[model samples]
Target: MSSTRTTETNGAEPTYKRRRTQRSPSPQYKLDDDDTYEPYISVAQRKQAKLAKLTSWGAGSDKDKANKLKEEEEERQDEEREEERRKERARKERTLLMEAQEVHERKAVEDSKKTETEKAEEHDAEILAAIASRRKLASDLELAQGVQYTEPVKTSWRPPRFIRERTSEQHRRLREKYHIIVEGDDIPPPIENFTDMKVPEPLIKFLKSKRITKPTPIQLQGIPTAFAGRDMIGIAFTGSGKTLAFCLPLVMVALEEESKLPFVRGEGPVGVVLCPSRELATQTYENVLQWTASIAKEGKYPQLNTLLCIGGISMNDQSHVMNKGLHIVVATPGRLIDMLEKKRFTFDHCKYLCMDEADRMIDLGFEDDVRNIMSFFKHQRQTLLFSATMPRKIQDFAQLSLVKPILVNVGRAGAANLDVLQVVEYVKQEAKMVYLLECLQKTPPPVIIFSENKNEVDDIQEYLLLKGVEAVAIHGSKTQEERQYAIKSFKSGAKDVMVASSVASKGLDFNDIQHVIIFSMPKEIEDYVHQIGRTGRSGKTGIATTFVNMNTPEQTLLDLKYLLMEAGQKVPPFLTSIEDPRAAQGGSLTGCPVCGGLGHGISNCPKLEDTQRRQMASHRVSDDRGGY
Candidate 1:
């Protein structure tokens, strides 16, 4: 045993068997295991033994045990809060050195990663430039091939000289074909004439400020019923003051309940307006603000707080605003849901809910969001569903939202404000731009050319400007500030022509829009109604033209026919001939014998391409594949 004194492995330190040079006198409770040979220990001795055991294990062992104990202590700090204050001095000292080292090491790693990221970006840029160069060469080669080899051109076709111009009688018949008629005599005037109706003065004032001297037939009927606290499903032609119908009631009801405050007014939104698109939401908000602001100016009205909660805005700002109350909020469904989840706003106190362009809201697949929002309201709120035309799907939403709503239609195929002169012209696809130029040269000022896509909108605007026409384009891709400037310029008579997409379709209040050119046929009949609606607004008469081709799909034509016919317009005999090429004009929905109700013949209907569509698709595909 004397020759076998214990030593540490590798480093030759004292081991378990080694004896201390000096040992304290054993306590009365000390055990053999507790010390070198004691078998029992006191509570104080045990605590000391634990501390010593931790220290003796390793340098890091003591630190880790201290950290774990500190974490446990922190967890119990609330119960031991007084004791935590007593131990604060030691607590700070224990973590101070480690925290500093960790911070320095973290910063060093971040700097290294940043340098690597910048280098990678530089490398990618060079590779992308090389790829672009190859794409450009390919496009050049294709253009050269097309120029070098050309097929014999087909003979240009011309229309019969007998159809040079349509007589007023022919125009009337065409309108009849589409069931477009001004049946003012048949449909009773909306009780707009009733002076004693309990309609709110604020709404009446709003209408006046907008320079609306009279309500459209739908508004006349719908407003009074809504004012009576009745739910309403209003079916009317587009541009017939439907917005005012629903908006007026919403504003009035909201203003009625809002708490008044001076200077630092709190937000207490009593009404909410939901729309499909941001453009529509913004337009509706502006309209509401214009009238509401005027009311505030009179010093009699509370500063009605109207907030906009649409997507594509700063979320942080939206969250902050939601914490504060709002008097009225105009929002698209998506952003409103996000805010609701984040507890930014509540619809609990919503006394009035308006779905402007209800058909569009449904068409855009917002029904589920709308339904979820409706559940948030406990009591049945005054609901209004406004649409240009009532499709089956929209009808379902209306029935669900409104509680026995009064159905109001101006007339059969509801007259789309007779002020709009709708005409259709046939043209070749390649010649569309030239035809547009011709129209500009011949048509009067303040014209709007509507395209379905932004690229086309930009192209048309640029082409028109190149031809020395003062035109500006507005689309979703443009910044809100840019859209506002363009709209202001157009309205101020500074710009003569505005090339636009569907962004200019709904609720945009632009006065003196004289003519609307369908640069491309709108996708839906309801959209078509709204597109032309822009022209003949606020009791102003306007002209609208749509270019149709023989290549226009029979289904599209039929849809157009049904849309017009539903509106009480008569279908053209030629359109009827589409279903029966050989049969005389008959009002029968015979299965198109061509493609067995597929709307095309086996050969022609299955894969038919109109001249313009084919050209546009080819050009678009080429541009995309050529990496333009």
Candidate 2:
């Protein structure tokens, strides 16, 4: 046979018969007619018709081949994805193993470097802090055992059902007019005038003689509550007659006791008043004296003895007064606690307890002492707590002490006086002294300059006196005599300016004070309010100028802005533009309600934090580690 097979030249072959490779796919059916000769048309019409019924021999075979190729491609793709997943898992496993080895090596090195004793010490330090914190917690729990609080409620307190001279609509209008917010149970409606206050005619004559015919917002609400035989808390701005509110009721109750019985020597005080500072105690004592003056030997009423038991004054004098069987005792917490502990006088006949500047008492670290004083009273006495600002720190004491107290909060609690013109100026710390000269010129004489501390008070007083400003300084360091002399001089026009610390800011009434200059702003905004309040007293308008610098705290600035805005004062651009997390609550609340701190919340209160840490530590140790 030739190399190329000879076949028919018509169509199936390329003119001559071509040999096919064995790898070529076999046809579905035999080409029966052409197998022996050459590749013919590949489909003889006769042969194709014979196998036509079998579609697999024709178009069906091509379709089957295409489906097989597609299946193979899909299988290959699945295998590739599976391989990628396996590789990723292997990579992760290797990384984990490498990390574990490194960690083990690091631990080995660390263990080698540290001695057993050193490690034990470190561990012990942490454990001790924990133990100390736990002790404080246990102590608080002990204090909390069966302890009661007035406790904040969402609803406002309703007035007690009593005989009222004024109509209910008139009472509603009066409360709304003065922005008085009342809370607690059995609250009595406020009075419209001083005539509505049912007291001895002698005290009424005294108020009339003093030209005080109308009752202030606090007096209207507070006096009635006290008269209703209920415990009460009075929160109002300074110079808003907070003193008269409690003082009037105090005098009335004392007179009532005096009317029923006569006092015997070495008997007891029927009423007791606690003040934070010696000056406040002295002033309150004077106010009580003025009210009692009508009921004393001078007036037609019976002689009612009121004693001022303050420090720097003779305890012998106080003892003598107590021995005479006083009607009322007004003394600072420190001296009062001492007097009570020494058995100088007993509250056996005491039916009234009035605490003025309650927040200051807590701040001065006299909360425990106040509690101790309360412990001396075996029977329930009518407790009255009055503060310009009611901080949350004092809330515990209020709750623990007062039983079902009526909270007569006038205006916004702890808000600065809107009537006082507040002026904020930027002055560097070093340049404050130089600028103070110009500030003194802003208002007339009878001005008060508040310093941050005693040392600063001395320095400012010296500078002002050297400049011939007729200034006098008062602070805790000064004896009661010196402080009284300074206050008298400032009030009598003997001294034009009174440079004092926060000790004088609480409840000292300076008549006709036109201006107050803050040499350096206090750390707290609440103090700032009280400092400025020194000038605006007894329903008169006043001015306050404060010096602030870049070094001043940002949170304080934020608080100051809100206070100024609340009082309708102009806020400086620098203060308004400032921002802080502490004021993220958008100034709805003036300062932190708990601690009166502008920089933090109740949860983050530094005072509470200390208590929290102490509660956690073993034996209540002093450390930063908080209780568990």
**TM-score of each predicted structure versus truth:** 0.59, 0.70
- Model 1: lDDT to the true structure: 0.63
- Model 2 off-target regions past 4 Å? 1-170, 297-299, 318-320, 582-591, 597-600, 603-628
Model 1 TM-score, all chains together: 0.59
Q: Which predicted model would earn the best lDDT?
A: 2
Q: In order, what lDDT does every prediction score? A: 0.63, 0.74
lDDT of 2 at 228: 73
Off by over 4 Å in 1: 1-190, 193-195, 199-206, 259-267, 315-325, 413-415, 479-481, 559-628
Residue range 94-122, candidate 2, lDDT tens digits: 87679799999998999899865455445
Residue 120 displacement in candidate 2 (angstroms):
35
